[model samples]
Every structure is written in structure tokens, then in C-alpha cells.
Target: MRTSGRRIVFLVGLQGVAWLLPAGTIIQQEEREPGTSKVKAQATISIDAGKLRMEQEKPGEGKSVMIFDQSKQVVWMIEPAKNSYMELTAAQVQQMGGQMQQAMKQMEAELANMPPEQRKMVEQMMKQRMPAPQAEKEVTVREKGQGEKVGPYTCIHYEVLTSGKLTREVWTAPMDQTHLGGAEFKTFQALGEFFGKLSGQAPKGTWELSGMNQMQGFPVRVLEYEGPRATSEWMLVKAEQRSLDASLFTLPAGLKKSSMEGMSRE
Candidate 1:
């Protein structure tokens, strides 16, 4: 399975806009077992970004393309396919960029129109909702504890309270590779309400793992996020360490350059 560079770009955009919650924290644990590094698997991802949706298909052969959609219907497609490039006219790229700038300006105007007290409340609530870091505590090996299954994996459960008034309980499962799954991580309901008030949504909230997984003999890491209104899954399907073709990332020479230098000044 090859990774999609476009997905990485989208995830970076999402993280840039996501407001940090006071109760948010990341936990990772890995198991070093022999032959684990030898196993590899492929994965498909479905991402929903409010107005736009994208589907990624990763297989053993050929390059991957991301199908774009709007309201459940296909609208456009972008692919960093092998040998062949997805051609985009320079005018189209500039038009898309201009529309994005306009949409951002509109969203900023909406936020700016919010009442002063409401804005303060939103900020305070976000601060309180962010995940708190775990204290200087060591994991003690316990004789036994409760066990549960999340999805197809079994997880060990643990609970903690942060300095803020938020509590969290997490269930983690160890996979063969460094990839760890937080099958069951619960956060405060108030956090959801707080985000809702601020016009933010995290359907699954921010809980997932990032690390290496092999796709079609290539070592790649999958970074995924699921929230109430949006879900994004990304994989570094191909990396330099795996002998990926350098030409795969280059733009096509056949693309014509645009002559619109004076248009923006007007």
C-alpha cells in the first residue's frame, strides 16, 4: 500500500485548526517481539471533512489516487499516481486557492461577530477542555486488572485524573508493529459541550495512534484522527527508506503556466 501525500497535507491543515483541549494527552507503549517487523498489511481510509469527502485505496501494485466528493457524490480527483501525473491547469489551482482564501475570511468574520462574553466563555471552556499531561508517575506492574475488547483487539484499562476537573479512562492494545490502538479512551462529556458551543466538532474526539506499518513491503506510518464533525486518516504509504521512486513526487512538465500576474492586483 502506498501513502498519499495529499492526505498528509490535509491532516496538517486539520491539526493547525484544531484547538487543544486541557484533558488531552497521548500514551504509547510498544512490544518488541521477534518477526514482528517482517509482517506487513494494507489499509483503506475514508475521510469526511464537512463539505468535502475523500476515499483512499492502497493496494500492493501501482499508485493510489484520492477520490474527492461533496455531499456523498464524487466531484473531483487528485492522485500522485506513478509515472502518470494528475494534471491540473494552473488557472484551476489559482482559482481553488482564491476560493479557499475567501472561505477562510468568511469564517473569521463569523467568529469575529460573536459576542464578547461568548468569546471569553469559548476560550475559557477550550482551555478547561484541553487534555492535561500525566504527572510524574511511573507505571507500576500490577498482578491483575480488568480487561476489555475494543473492536477486534483486547485492551488493558487504566484510569487517571488530571489537575483540571477532567477524568479519563483509556484502554490500549498492542499490535505486532509499533502501532498501538487506543480501543477505548473516554473523555469528559463537558469537553464535547464546550466544543459544541465554540462551533467545533470532534465526533470521535482526538484519540488515535501514529507510527510505522508496512504496506506492500514498504515501511509507512498511519496517522489518523476522528472527531464529531470530521475524520481524517493518513498513511505515509511510501518513504525514502523503502526505495520509493523520487519522480513520484514531481509535477508534470506538460502543465501550462498561467499569465495572470496583473489579475490579483486589480
Candidate 2:
């Protein structure tokens, strides 16, 4: 089934904000289309010490949980409806990267033996089918101004530019004012660095893990765009600094562990 463009933008907004979330806080965020008050998607994030859990729900995409354990350097993606979970570790990610490199080497060897004309044609087809590597763009962040109210907090407005074009507009409040712990904020920074290695291992229909290597403070509101057109808006609906249950960071008992090999086959 094909996914509509609107739904795709909604998912991107949800996941992008997840990367911006601070630890030791429970946050509820809603994503909406640019000109309307109607919510298109929403997510809840819980962060404690070095553990983080996010629950997200979409219209047709059901709910899923993502847990990142900094102590173990592992990430678990749970599908409640399927009664199963997928685990990713740093070592496993390294092994997969090695395998991909070997596969590329094999393909290159096969292409070398082909006729010049055939090789050119096959190369063109490969370029069309495979996504080319994206060059990293220079990202610059500038404070737009100060004292903007978002939800219950007054925030500082900032703009993020990529290659000199506006990419994201963000409003943030100081972590101290939000009453969230600063230790977890540092832990989340480490989490971002860790998951930066496992680039594409998250569930297909769910969120992708990304790092918040740039910009700081608790994000109160975020606006994402493509070129000049705004795509989606995310607002912090609720933020609480309270003790969360330990079980919220753990997988359910008796749940089957899904293997990466098995997942690839599907």
C-alpha cells in the first residue's frame, strides 16, 4: 500500500522531535498541519537517567515502543500487536556494516567482467534503484529572539539552517526552568551519539532513531519545512517531572525476540 504525502510529513515531524526530547521528563507532543488546528499525529516520551522510552500512535500505523538503554548500549523496538521485539547492539551494527561492504565488493567484481556497454547500462540502472549517499550539509543555528510563550513556558526562538536554507524553527525553555534533571539531558546526548551508528535499524512504519548533536535546551515547540513551504508543527502539550515506573523501560516477559535475519527476510 502506498502512503499519502500528508501522513509521511506527519511521521517525520513526530520522529524529528523525538530526537530533540530531553531525558528525566515526560513530554506529550502533537503534530498538526500548517493551516489547521487539527492534530495529525502525536507522541509521548519518557526519559530517566540513561533510559528512554517513546510511545507513538498514527492513524493507520498502530502504536509502537522504542527503548534505548545507555548502560547496555542497546535499543529495543517493540511491536505489542505482534508480541515481539527487535534488538540492536553496537556490535551487531558493526557486523552488518561489514557484511554490506562485502556485498558491495562482490557486486563491483561482477560488474568489472561485463562488456563495456552492458556495464554502463547496469551502472545507470543501479544508480536509479539505489539511493546515493547524501553529503552532510553545514548546519547553522541562530537565536531569532527571546520571550515567546509556548504551552505553559516562555521560550527562546531559534532557527536552524542547512546549506544556508531554513530547515527548522524551534522554541525552547531552559532545562532548569522546566524542572527536569540535567544528568538525563547529558545522557540523551550520549544516546544520540550511540544511535548515530545504527542509522536505519528502526522499524519501517515507525520512527527512526536520530541524534541531537546540535542545539540545546528543552524544545517547547518546533516547526519543520521544505524549502519555503512549511510542512508540520509540533507543540509541547504537557511536560511533567515525576518518577516513572522502571518497567516502562523494559520489555514485557514472554515476548519473542525477533532476529535481524528473520526481519530481513520479511
TM-score of each: 0.22, 0.72
Which regions of candidate 2 fall more than 4 Å away from where they truly are? 1-24, 97-135, 198-214, 260-266
- Tens-place lDDT per residue, model 2, 39-58, is 87778888888888888777
Q: What is the lDDT of residue 143 in candidate 2?
A: 85
Query: Model 1: per-residue lDDT, tens digit, 108-154?
Result: 57668899898777657744664321222222222123445544444
For candidate 2, the clash count comes to 0
Candidate 1 global lDDT? 0.31
Clashes of each: 19, 0
lDDT of each: 0.31, 0.71
Among these predicted structures, which one has the highest TM-score?
A: 2
Cα shift from native, residue 152, model 2 (Å): 1.7
User: Can you give the lDDT of residue 76 in candidate 2?
Assistant: 84
